[model samples]
Target: KDPKACTILLRGASKEILAEVERNLQDAMQVCRNVLLDPYLLPGGGAVEMEVSHRLTERSRAMTGVEQWPYRAVAQALEVVPRTLIQNCGASAIRVLTSLRAKHTQEGNSSWGVNGET
Candidate 1:
């Protein structure tokens, strides 16, 4: 019974909800522990995926006829992440994805992510 330690009592209207809350809390604690063990974070909301897609698309442009298709295909596949993010936010996926791609193409702009709050 350490007074300084974090503690909380959660109440749910149903057993299922309480179990879900417990699971979520446990997951959050695990994430905190992992963060303490190794402090690092990947770009959220498809930023890294978009960056990879941009690089692959750029690389495809430099290759010969047949060799470029695979790079292009993979680049297109990776775009699904950001596109889904935009669609979930009730925005035009095509327009936002085009903008996101353009942003990632610029200098020192690899961290640009899809705006999920829209």
Candidate 2:
């Protein structure tokens, strides 16, 4: 669960690949904002609620797309994207999602706990 380790490993990865990943992520973010926040897409409260659900689903899809390219590029670069990156990304993502959930729970908005608590 050491983020520094992940950072160092990523640093060793080609800067070109890393830059591509960053660009992809930025594009995904833009798509998310466009689809989720467009006033014309949801002009009412119930519409907004449904749009939020749709947006969340699409966000997952977007993230998958963003990760896919870098994953393939990394695999090509190293002949295999290290299992470490795969595991570390999964772990780090879970940690981040759980932390956000905890924040929401503390605010009396949700209640969920992740495994791997230490």
Candidate 3:
């Protein structure tokens, strides 16, 4: 009904480029539609993983014995998500991980994450 509200008109030099643009536009449009239907969007990046890892790690300390090991292992594994994100961004994994860990542990800020731009 609203002609100019949400429309895509792509023009390209070659068929291949046009096709690629059309495909990408379709994919983006689908994402927009899905978001509109289900507005509950999870936090992007590794924030969720870090939060889960932090909670798991804290709970692991309460366990009596060997049961704690699994929780600790899973928590450590969850941390790999953000660590890999940092390394993929051409940053020092060790430095970023250390900083993140300190922020979460010492400062009690579980949401702290490495800025990819750095």
Candidate 4:
């Protein structure tokens, strides 16, 4: 049995162009090596913010004192992640966020999010 791969030939206008492409490919490979070696990945794409906001909101509701206000404020601020994502996608932030919130509540899935393309 043979492990196999195909060669990719990059044609460029000049030696410098090829050199630059090679340098970028090497840089990307180095990053892959680092990831493989360390294997530490941070949560991204607004998931962490959304989860934090949800948890804080729940915790705030359970509180019966002034401390709840601060937690509520932080939760509301955490919402900016999804709101900004929708806004940047050229969608109506209020409408999308309202829909997203409804979906999350109804489906009971914290991962529910707006489709930026739609």
Clash-forming residue pairs, model 1: none
Number of the predicted model whose lDDT against the real structure is largest: 1
Q: Please, what is the whole-model Cα lDDT of each candidate in the order they appear? A: 0.90, 0.43, 0.82, 0.77
Ranking by lDDT: 1, 3, 4, 2
lDDT of 3 by residue, 39-112 (tens): 87654457668778878988999998898999999999998999889988999988877777666675446557
Candidate 2 per-residue lDDT, tens place, 28-73, comes to 8798888878834323212222233333444455566566565444
TM-score of each: 0.64, 0.24, 0.57, 0.55
The C-alpha stretches of model 4 lying farther than 4 A from their native spots are 1-45, 106-108
Which is better, 1 or 2, measured by TM-score? 1
- Give residue 5's error in model 2 in angstroms: 23
Candidate 4, clashing residue pairs?
none
lDDT of 3 at 82: 93
lDDT (10s digit) by residue, model 1, range 1-118: 7586877799999999999999999999999999999999666689999999999999999999999999999999999998888899999998888888889989988988887787
Q: Least accurate stretch of 10 residues (summed lDDT) in model 3? A: 102-111
Q: Which residue pairs collide in model 3, if any? A: none
- Worst 10-residue stretch by lDDT in candidate 4? 100-109
